[model samples]
Target: MFDDTFCLNVRFLLNTQFKMIELPDNIAALQSYKPGKAVEDIFEGKNFDRTAILSSNENNLGTSPKAVAAIQEAATNSYLYPDPSGMKLRQKLAAKHNTTIDKIIIGNGSDGILSNIFKAFFRPGDELVSSAGSFVAVNVMTKLNNIPYKQAPLTKEYAFDLEAILDLVGPRTKAVYLCNPNNPTGAMISNRALKAFIEKIPEHILIIVDEAYAEFAASLSSEFPDATQIELPNVITLRTFSKAFGLAGVRLGYGVGSQFIVDTLMKVKLTFNPSIIAQAAGGAALDDAAFMQETIEMNKKGLAYYYKNFSQMQLNYVPSFGNFVMLDMSTEERAMYVFNQLLNRGVFVRPLAFFQLPHCLRITVGLPEECQLLVEKMAEVMTLEKN
Candidate 1:
C-alpha cells in the first residue's frame, strides 16, 4: 500500500546522508595490520601438521608450569573485576627492577603501553624518529595520530644506524623510538652505542627503547644494554611477558620510567588493563626462574643452529640476537616462492614484505626436529625454484 514515489524519495535522501559521512583522513589512510599468513588460511582444511607454526616468534618450549597453574586458578575468579590500577603486577615488576611501584606502568601488552605513550607525550607537531624497517606499530600509531616522522635507513649490516638516527634529531624531534634486536631483522644495538645515543638526545625530547627481545639478547651477549639502568628522566624502557616468558596468550607487558612519565601514562592508559588472568600469569611466571632460563638457553641454541645451517646452505642471513633469523632470499619473488612452498609442506614462516624487507623471510627456531624438517623442506623448495 506504500506509494512508490514516496519510498524512492526517502531512500534517495537516506543514501545522500550516508554518502556525506566522510572518515577523517588519518583514519582513512590506515592500512590494517596484516600479519603473516595463518596456517588455517594457507591449508584450508588440508591434512597437515598443525604444530609447525614458526611465523610469530612464539614459544618453542611450552608455557611455564607455574604460570599454567596460576592461569587456571585465576580463571575461576572471572566474576570479579581486575584491580583498576594493576598494582600487584606492577609491584612485582618494580621489585624485580629495583624500582618503586610508582615507577612502573602495566598494560595489556607493550603495544598498549605504546598507545599510552603516544597519548601521554605526543602532540600534533611533534616529530618521532626511528629506522625505516623497525616495528610497524610505530607506523600505525604515528599515522593514526597524524604525527610526522623522520626515518633513517638501517645500516648495511641490518643494524640500527645510531649515528644517522642521532643526526635526524632536531628541534622538532620530540621523541625517538628504538627497537633493539629489532623485529624481523633481529640485530641489537650495543650497550656502548645505546649509551652514546641516549646521552646526545636532548633532555626535552623523550627516548623510548622498546626491548621486547631484551631477555634473549642479554642471555646470549655480554654487552647488551640494560636500558633500565640508564635512570634518565626522559628515558622509558618497554618490555613484554609475551616473548621470553611464554605467556603471549595472556598479553601482559609494562614500561619502566621516571615517576613523572609513569604517572602521565597511567592517566592515559585504560583502567583495569591486563585482566585478572594476565596479572596472575605474569606474577607467577616471574617466579619461575628455571623456566625463563631454559627458554633463554633454548633460544640461544636455536639461533646458533640456524646460523650453522644457513651458513652450510650458503644462504645469506642476518646474524640474529632474537629467537628468529631473517633470510635474504635475494628477491621478493624468491622469498614468496619459498614461503608458499614451505606452507604446502606444513611449515609456516614469516615473509617480511609488510616489514619493508620484501626479499627477506623470518624463520623462528622450532624444536630440533622441527628445525630439521624446515631445512629439509627448504632444500626441496630451493631445487624446485631452480628448475
Candidate 2:
C-alpha cells in the first residue's frame, strides 16, 4: 500500500533537482542555427492571399514529378525498415560520379554527414579552421562538439580568403571547412585558386569542401571545381539533393571521399539515417535530368532579372554564382527595416544578422513571377523609405 501523496511529492522533488542540473560548458555556450522564416507563420494573420518565399534557398518550381511518383510508390513499403546501408542509392551516386561505391556515404542531409565526420575525427581542443561569414553550420557543429575553431575573414569581394586560412593552420589543425559558392554572400573561389590553396594545406589536415550548391554554380561558371573529380585523399566533398534536384523535403545528402574516410564515417553514422522514401526520391530526382535542367534555367532567368533591377536601382550586391544573391542594404538598421517591410507586404527574405553580415539580406532566386514580384516589392519598399 503506497501513499499516493507521498509519491507525488517525491517525484516533484526529483524533477526540481533534475531541472537544476548543470549542462556542459560547451553545450551551454552554443548558439542555435536559425533558419529562414516560414511563409505560413509570416502570413498567418495577414490579409495577403499570396506570398513570395525567397528566404530559404529552395527550388520554387516544386519537387520533380518523377521524384513525387517515386515517393508515392515507396510509401507502400513503409512497414519495412529502410536499407540501413543505403547500398542502392550509394551505387547509383558512385556510378554517376565515376567512383567506387565505397567512396559514397549517405546521410539524413549534408548536416548529418558532417556530424558523423566531426564525431569520428575531431577531439576537444583540436583546431578547425574555416572562413568567417561562410556557412554557419560548421561553426555551430564545432562549438557543439567542443572542438576549438578559428575563422579567417572573407576577402573584400566577400570570397573565401585562402591565404588567410592557410596562415591560420598549424600543427594542431585537424580540419578545414570550405563552403564553395558560399552561403549568404554567394561568392566562389576559382578552380585555380582552390587547387593552389589545397596544395598548401598540410597532409594531416582534412579538407571539407561543402558543395551543397555546386549544381547551381557549375551551370553558371566552368571555373568551379568538382571536388570529387580531384584525386586528393584528404579532400571530402559534401553534396545534397536539396537544391537543384528539388528534393529538399526528402532530406537526402551524401559525402564523397576516400575509402578510409568513408569507412570511418560509416562507424559513426546512425543505422538507417535516411528513410526508404528519401532514398527513392533521391534516386528518381537524379534520373530526371530534364527537370534538373529546367530548374537551372529558371534560376538563371531569376538571377538575370534580379541583377538588372538591382543595378538600375543603384544598389550594391554580390555577383552570385549560386541560386541566391546577397543585397547590401549599407546599414544594419536599413536591412532590418527592409526585411520587416517586405514581410508586411507578403514577401520573405533572409536577413544576415545571425550570420554576422548585418548589412545584407540573402534572397533566393525563385520562379520568374516570384522574382518579378520581389523586384516590385523592393521598389515600393525603397520608395516608402525615401518618403
How would you encode candidate 2's per-residue C-alpha lDDT over 207-304 as one tens digit per residue?
99999999999999999988888767788999998989888888999999988889999998999779999999999998999999999999888898
Model 1 reaches what TM-score against the true structure? 0.93
RMSD of each: 2.8, 2.4
Return the clash pairs for model 1, or none: none
Cα lDDT tens digits, model 1, 1-387, are: 579988778889888543467889999888776797555476667787543778888777879999999999999998999998888888899999998998898899898899889888987799999998888889888988888978999999888999999899988898999998899799999999999888888889999999998899898788899797779899999999988999887889999999888989989888778899999999999999999898888888778887887887788999988888999999999899889999889888999887888999999987777787888888788778777
- Clashing residue pairs in all predictions, respectively, total 0, 0
Instruction: List where candidate 1 sits over 4 angstroms from the true fold.
Output: 1-9, 12-17, 33-44, 49-51
Backbone clashes in model 2: 0
Off by over 4 Å in 2: 1-19, 31-39
TM-score for each predicted model, relative to the true structure: 0.93, 0.95
Residue 267 of model 1 has an lDDT of 90
TM-score of 2: 0.95
Q: Model 1, 381: alpha-carbon shift in Å?
A: 1.4
